[model samples]
Target: MFDSATRRELYEFTRGTEKFYYTSGDAEVELNDVVYEQITISRSEIKNSSDLEKDPLEITFARDSKFAQDCLRSALEENVYVKVIKFQHGQQSILWQGRVVSVKPSGASIVLKSETNFTKLGRAGARLKFQRTCCHDLYGNGCRLNKADWGVQTTIKSVTANAIELRDLSFDDNYFRLGMLQSAFGVSVGIESSAGNTVNIIRRLDSLADQITSDADLLAYQTAVLELDQTIATRDALDENDPNYEQDFADAQALVDQKQEAFNIASESVFFVVAYPGCMKSLTACDRFNNTDNHLGFAYMPEDNPSTTRNA
Candidate 1:
């Protein structure tokens, strides 16, 4: 067994070595092959805390490239997951893992803030499940709970870290019963599903749990496929003076004239937006794998467990 001081020294030595990996979402985690560019790790630590007031970890880092910036930005906007790992001399450990909550500009660099996935579960409008989470709760040690004699089946419409949106309980005494259950067990109200198969359990995808084995090859798939946005209309019908005019001066004017004539003739054609959802590996891409397509597509993945709905 490695001593505590020896482990600390090993970690310091590894920091001075070469590089680390930052992957988005819970995909395949490997020591090699899937490694992206070498990243600079500034600060990383996990503090053991039984004290309720303090967080169990403190981690922060900076990525100088625009690709990293874009990836981090997309993660923050979509609430996607991210992880940083280091491997050396036959030993590897996860340095930090969390959902990217914020990405901000710091001078010429980009700053990323990742909180434990549980923290994201606490955000307003988060979906909740009654029985277990996608992966183990980082701070809660998987939030493993034994079934007790008492059981409650409450529909959780929404949740924040501290509170949950429950149905049918507010008017009835079930709310008080829930509060009593919380007081007795010190468990989060939205942790587990009941044994009966009546209500819908919350579905969560946690990439960090040992029970959840993700396909390594599929994990590398990155792209956030945006919903086909008809939000912006095609500019084919725009006049030169139109604010949304996209074509050149002559072409725009010609199109406007054509549109007017077409309207008089009752044209059967409908204009389609030629916009292609942006792809990564482009000049504007951050990490090649961190793009809008992957984030949007991930939403369609089936829930981790079968107790709840398949695709929500």
Candidate 2:
């Protein structure tokens, strides 16, 4: 027994030492802060350690530098829309630091456990929502949570159930409830509306186009290209004496290039299909079925159909 401790103290202490209290709680301590939890201080030995050395016996300093980088890295990879600068989690070196496991069945507080093998959090589990900024940063982005239980301090990114129409996805620094946040820094953390996206697409398309020279000029240019192609296909002619032949060739090539550019513009957004087989087969079918003239362009059914397609 310790010289300072009495026999009665030792007997009383020995019995209390065997008590096993299991709990889940968070050790609300800041990073780099020094803290400790006594594991198994003996009956009388609890008092004799003060005089042993200058460093003293019992406390351990919790530092973030060792594992902070790792913790942040893990959270960012597993959680989406996570801002690393605002994220924090329990320091493993800290005696009582914990992680919220889930919400209790009652949907009030959360179930938590210490990150260490031999420790537990405060008196009992917390609401988890109490640590919104931390929990949201650590778990919420793509967390598979059930809304029927547990309330997180942070606003969730998304939820299931057709009945629960998502109101919005705006969040703040804490990524907590958007309706109640201190400030939303940088861009609004809101999902773009269907209308907004459509407008953006239209603006992009308009930006890509420029004014035409004139309808008359366009038609004349078209006529020149048609004549050049038709004449070129007719014969292998040496038109060195014809002053317009070179100009016609250039114009026709220019038209082809321009048309190709036009086709490229619609490449991703639209598609067309020329059905009913080859021209000969198509003409035959037209006669056999008594079908009228028709134009098929930019029709869609999710993917390309088995036919030649052209732009409208």
Candidate 3:
């Protein structure tokens, strides 16, 4: 029920050593108290947005209990869900959901591993396609999406010259609007700002060197890009000869591409465009789909419908 790619990604996520309790209905199993070798469990999450995997559980236990063996085997066949609860000082703190991936006997121990529901859904729903209009397609076409699914919720505390302070900050709540955006530019959740014919574009300013409006501004933008490039350069110097060098290089290029795109977007307005906030952009790298970062580009807003720009 799990794919090799999903397994590899999850295996990497749960490398560190930790101890937790395994729970399923009325059954609660105690884990190793002092790094016991026979009984072990590891958990982690897969690192993708659309294909985001869930935290999986890997268990290695002694084959002394027939009940344990029977339960694991039954769960694997029935595809039952299990909860991994983390406790601190005798108080439960974190909870994770997973399904049995494998249950096999190895010598004196029963080796069992369960994958997170996230990965399970990804694998099971891989062929299941849900057709819908994206923000990129329906940005100005009056096709609105439920903001609670995409936007975050946070409270505005105070606005400062350099930064905006927020209270009760929460992300991924869709209903929450950036307080600083609302305070400074009258931007709120579900509200679209009209460019109102005042919006104009500055073409061909694709890179730091190309966006040189003034010597001072040019120096500033160039310096910022140079600093970012230097960090990437340092990483490349350290890991260029590694096995994953090509993948690392691609990731770095994607980052540089994102930065350049941001610079180009900012060049549209003297201050900042109401419709073109960098925060609105999707920052994650989608390597499985062609290493593409889905976000606002030069042709994001249509020339005909310039007024409507806010999208989630």
Candidate 4:
């Protein structure tokens, strides 16, 4: 209760299955044997507003704290749920709940900008539209696709700018287009296109870039590229009239593929799981997933509005 003199504030930050508990006190607080580490944490006042603009809660953590380091490492882009609780004696009551929308690193502290459910409700968008494509989200209620069936577990083979190569995917090219690539640490990147084992991401993944930059195999890929080029050049110089030219060219091509495969395997250090996104078109829904029955699109919808169209 607010009237209690012994009341303290407890903060809980959650990202996927991971949770961090902290308290703004002189020492750590133990509740049910779980320790909430003492940290310099504070949040802005929650307010009510009539406008649609978000009323963000700015939560700050000490720059040097372990939680701040975690935030910098991966939590900046991921959705982190924040809960504030008022604790007195052995009782606890939730004071605020929200999901982090953005993060700012100040000179002395890391600040998280978060918003409540009301912000989502106030967002400007029609809930549904009269379009030819499906209105439902992939793997959502109306789509009714099993996400687990579409997921593929693989390791990072290499990364070049916004493109990432994973263990060879047997699926056809563009199978993962408009899909998601999630790292073992829960950082997710959107897939723009996929071919063979390589995926082109919609945006740069800073966390993954940092990891690949320091990896020892970064140089290995460069060396592999040079070796592959040399092999191709040697194959191209072969004379067609020579008796052993065919065998020589085949051997050279084989070596190139082998070297490239080895290079991909050598660079494997991090694990990632990718899943294919559902198609919005009715024809794709039927041809790809054989899920025409659950298709939410109005494929036969008229191009012109019935109410507005008239014979000239």
Top candidate when judged by TM-score against the true structure: 4
Which 10-residue span in candidate 1 carries the lowest summed lDDT? Answer: 222-231
C-alpha lDDT of candidate 4 relative to the true structure: 0.71
Residue 232 lDDT in candidate 4: 77
Q: What is the TM-score of each candidate against the true structure?
A: 0.28, 0.14, 0.24, 0.51
lDDT of 1: 0.33
Instruction: Give per-residue CA lDDT, model 1, range 153-271, as digits (tens).
Output: 33333334333333333232221321211211122212222212112123231211112212331122111111111111233334658664554545645655655554533312211
What ranking emerges by lDDT with the best candidate at the front?
4, 3, 1, 2
lDDT of each: 0.33, 0.25, 0.38, 0.71
Winner on TM-score between 1 and 3 is 1
In the range 90-138, model 4's lDDT, one tens digit per residue, is 6899888888877767766788888875677867753567666766656
> Which tens-of-lDDT digit does each residue in 196-223 have in candidate 3?
2211122111122221144344455556
Summed over model 3, clashes come to 3
> Model 2 segments beyond 4 Å from truth?
1-201, 204-213, 237-312
Ten residues in sequence with the least summed lDDT for candidate 3: 7-16
Model 3 CA deviation exceeding 4 Å by range: 1-55, 72-75, 125-312
Model 3, C-alpha of 114: deviation from truth (Å): 0.7
- Backbone clash pairs for candidate 4 read none
